[model samples]
Target: MTDLNQTALQKGADRALEKIEIDTLVVGAGQAGVAMSEHLTKLGVPHLVLERNRIAEAWRTGRWDSLVANGPAWHDRFPGLEFEGLDPDAFASKEQVAAYFEAYAKQFNAPIRTGVEVKKVVRNAEGPGFTIETSEGVIQANRVVAATGPFQRPVIPPIAPKDDSITQIHSAQYFNPQQLPEGAVLVVGAGSSGVQIADELQRAGKNVYLSVGAHDRPPRAYRNRDFCWWLGVLGLWDAEAAQPGKEHVTIAVSGARGGHTVDFRGLAHQGVTLVGLTKAFNDGVVTFQADLAENIARGDENYLSLLDAADAYIARNGLDLPEEPEARATYPNPDCVTNPILELDLAKAGITSIIWATGYSVDYSWLKVNAFDERGKPKHQRGVSGEPGVYFLGLPWLSRRGSTFIWGVWHDAKHIADHIATQRKYLAYRDASQRSAKD
Candidate 1:
């Protein structure tokens, strides 16, 4: 029996060496991968998308049951599919998003290989091709588009230095409020996830301490001067810092850096005390760096400044004013007010649970390809990388609205698929030339 098991393992390892032939191989099947496949199929391109798990795994396994998209329903749909439901404003649940992704794959007949975990992706030194090693099999393609997404890994500060008594968990592992420790809880990271988690814990009757970071605050309503409109108008969604122009800006100024878009006002009303940025956690007490209100205000100002810069760029470039496609009425100086902030120590507040809502990290160490920028972010232009035939999708700010939301991925996918088609032709020509030379 032991020999049989060993034989099977060896066979699987050998199969990993057999490089299957393909035109293009995408390493992911989440929103970005599905969108890429849809675009490629629409353009009649031959490609394969590799997913280690079922489609839309994040929506299936990561999110909480009570969670709904922060953005409107219209903003949730991907390419070739419209969000279906009675309420257009109603946010879709995680299950709904997953179902839609599954349907998208079936509807378009996207060539996807599920349960195929990509082990490594490396550029072929001999030619303008690349090799991808996966658990199911190996594949060599003329082009590779990594749609693995930014949230490839859960990130916890290496040294949180928190007391052993304080239970700590990343937001990825958190399911619901019931899982929280008894007594008060301190939710760190004020991004969308952090604020949302804090809101839930407080509503569940648990005393909650929210560590507020610098973050953008947008109105919940759709048909108004919301953040998305400003995103469109300012071209923040499409502007790239790598682009050689004054329109480009670093991510720090963008305020779109981390995914923190929860309704702070609602959370505050629920009695979730917003504290300043957490400096350290030890001896059952959380130390803060500055005033919570000051940090939040600074974050809001950064977001507003980015918007202003974007608006200026539009005027300078002679771009037409953005039309609010679904906006019903403008909320000029709306009644919505800023969520007031408070600074309090966790130990004094008697907080028990500690949830880190501090966003995610992307690790491309497995890729082993020379395609990243100084910050390890993939160097790509609308999904096409500097390395010929290499591409990336679902990257933040790849194009207008392409990075932050699912609805925006199509813009980058369409362009990337078009680029893939050209590469396919190039590969075909090259192969023919090689055969003729041999003959």
Candidate 2:
């Protein structure tokens, strides 16, 4: 976790650049990059890890103050290091998560140089490797692993009007309810962040309007096990993303205030006005789709389906898991659906802020390699890219549903490191064979 802000390595423009050669270079200090470094170290492979900011920068700066890991400590942690003194089912807070990563980096004295940003990476035309141009010195490496992670660019829909009275911010920018202006708040997107933010604002004595959309809702815990435990037992964690026709599922659970199942009906009961997907915002008027009832129904369906599967698994395996029938119960908020507010004048509703909880977009423009498709998605099997020695780690669905999590990225990194080891061996063997031929 060394800060090189005052050093020559941090100032790339003024420093006299020299060619630095290495066998492997990992570009990130987050979970993916650090895991990759660990694997390389185990293989006795020498590589340098470059980071634009300090270790676990995202956890420290990008997230809200009270945010916790969506997954339980036992499920999402890296191997060889257990989350100390915490219950297996308890969620780790953002600061604790950040500290864990920092400790992990220090455990092996990872070759991580913070304050070094990678601007561009391209194939070395003059040689058989890659030329990485960074904020620091340039490095020519036989292999490069782009472990920059999934959440790079935030996306906000361009529908809001110019309302100077209202404070608009993306969910990533939101820290807490006190950060917003004093008035009603509108939270767009019904994903994990959106629901959590809307709930928090409502609990803080603010009138909150939550935009509901297609989402998957599973119980926080079921039958004496967390929902994630069921997923693991069902082999869903190792499975790839479902077909396109299926629902677009983002994690909707919150580890805040002792996590509970996400329910629009329950939120509506708590006075958080649940509306349909936002249609537009213009001229101090906000309109929504007439599908509030449908959204609630959809979430209920997702919830029940998961419970049914869990029950079936228990019965089929002849295991003695409890049959908590109360988990299947749902109380409908008739006013929320029957009297849905499809439109509202911003001034009339007293709404003073809008938090866009829309997710993120992956940016790989700096990676100037033939490893992507027309849709800008990386083209590869697992983490190994089509371009030799160019790999992408810590991406969603890169290998399985778990690839987006800490443990999953570690597995992906190990695979990439093993591949690099094989490639290095091939290089040495080629030289030996050529010398033998000359003799």
Candidate 3:
């Protein structure tokens, strides 16, 4: 490992700006970046990982202090390390997770430059590679990996708009319950965050209202099957294309919709009131329609039935035999928390404090690169962008249900690293051939 002093780092960055060569340049040092960096190093690929802030800054800085991950630590553990010594089923604090990531970077000696922001990426016309314009300096590399995850930007719903009288804040900005106004609160979007926030506010003795629309509900116990078990037995999220063809139906099905559904039944047991989808909030009053809950409940039923059918098919095919798969815990159905919701007859109820948990939006506007589809998201085939030498990781449905998970990044990283290696080999072969022709 090189002793990266400030002056030395600056000089190297400056030289890199002058068309210096590199095997790979990775952006973002979060889970994806760190995992990819370690894998690339193991493969003996010369590379550098760039981060806009300190390592795992988002986890360390953005998330609230007391907030714990909804998913258990087992499922969220990063590759090459297991979360132990604490409660196994316990959710990790943001600090704990951040420390783990930093330790991982140190273990692998990942070359990460903090406080360096990559502003733009320009592909070379002659086909050798691309140049990344960064705040530190220009960097030239044969390949670039955009490891920025899905939560790049917060998505605020248009219905809430932005007004002076009522306060608006994304779940990202929310810290303590004191941030909300001293009145009845309305939290929109019924995924994990919305439900959790509503629960938190209710516990704090604040009169709270939750507006939930279409959401997939899971039970806290399995009646006969666990979806995670089914996923593993069916090899639903295994190595395969993320397209919608015959070999990839499972990946398409579990795409990122939003936060996970919470134990709503538990919330109801706690006496928190829920509402339907919020249609409008104006003139110091919130307006909602009646049919929102009916529609949401219908969607929930259909999704559960689909899972049940898949489980049955798996059993019929002798898929869940003891010797055929690794023994694991069964998936639990979400506790239905819908009963506690107040009907969205907003005209009759008074509400305050709007928390927009509607969802997150993908923002690539700053990149200034032409690599997205009609949906304003970067388009990639197995992490390979349509343009040469540009790649992406941590996309919602990039490869499978596990694509965004910490464990899932390992497989995706290996595949992408292999692809980059192949490209490097081809370039070497082509250069050799061109020289022979000239000679």
Candidate 4:
């Protein structure tokens, strides 16, 4: 729900007011856009990247202060760059990751114009390309890669009562444990963000209630290798999103405390209360579904399935890897799910704040293209859209399971760059003034 609109309002007072034209206009300066810039430059395709704010703005501000990447540094990075002053297995802090992107862009000398807010993009009135209305002025480009990413805005469920007595905020706005009021905290989602935040609060001596939802609980390491490496080796990273049973599979892996398996039971044993999916909220009372047991069972199922597949793959390959028995060991179900409270009054429970760790809702209102579906999702094959010259990148499951990862964006950009290289406009545009309707 946040953008650098205020910064845009300040405007680029230092730059000139002259109009601009290009063959390809890259929208965003995040990992995706920067990667696109690298490949376009390598392929001799001229392009410009327009960013509303500085590079890696989200990693610097949108996430929590204590957050680290879910994947380790070695397996989660681009092909040629290794994180500085960090071990390969270490999880790079948010600050380090942001710094890496800034340095990466500088290394390539990417043609990036920061602080440029693209207000709207539509077909040219008198030509065959796009006319972009920006805060600085106007621009024309034959092709545009919408690389702003999918997590444009946060989405909080409408179940919570519209009351101001208790503080509430989306996880994107959360920075640390001390910023919240002194009392119990209710986090309504069990994804990586919600679970990690809940763990931090409980460790800080605050009561935390986590609403368990559907998520894949993969071990941080399996068969002497991290799950990220296994995914790459097993070709799961390139797995198609259209495959069955992948409809709702958000991984709950975390790289905290030197990286460990994601265990909700362990969280419950450590004093963090686990509850089922949040149902509704009245004046101050909250209702929860009586499905906590089912939720825990589903997580257990996912955990076992991964172990089983890894074992089978190892046996088939005849790989000599040490057996990690703890991953398959069963533990007793915690009391939170077995004898849980179906409803509770927030005031009586001493819960003073609520954090909604729900996922994001994208905003493509500025994209005046006929490439989106009824739900506003882009109707595309991989990154190629039904509407020509409009491509999407850095979106989850855009091409495969790893499409959302940083390295995935890098490799995916190469494909897009190669495709654009086939166009006659790649080397040079005909002219800046005369863009015919058929062009």
Ranking by TM-score: 2, 4, 3, 1
Best model number under TM-score: 2
lDDT of 4 at 198: 94
lDDT: which is higher, 1 or 4? 4
Error of 4 at 194 (Å): 0.6
Which tens-of-lDDT digit does each residue in 42-119 have in candidate 2? 886777788899888989898888888888999878996878787888899988888888888777767777888889
How well is each residue in 208-299 modelled by candidate 1, as lDDT tens digits? 87776665554332223445555666555565553343222212211121223344444565576666677775554456766565655555
lDDT of model 3, residue 231: 54
Q: Which scores greater on TM-score, model 1 or model 2? A: 2
Clashing residue pairs, backbone N/CA/C < 3 A, model 1:
184-352, 191-260, 192-260, 192-261
lDDT of 3 by residue, 1-439 (tens): 1223323433464244434457788899998999888888777677878898988887887765466654456656775776646565556777877888888887867777778888888877665667778887777777888888888888887777456656778888887788777777778777656776777788889877777676655432232333444455657657455433332111101111122334443355566665667777565466666655474555456456645656576568866533312112223323333343323333345555678876666656545567887877788987888977788988766777678777787678888998887876787799799999999
The window of 10 residues in a row where model 4 has the poorest summed lDDT is 1-10
TM-score of every candidate: 0.78, 0.94, 0.80, 0.92
The backbone clash count of each candidate, in order, is 4, 0, 11, 0
Better by TM-score, candidate 3 or 2: 2
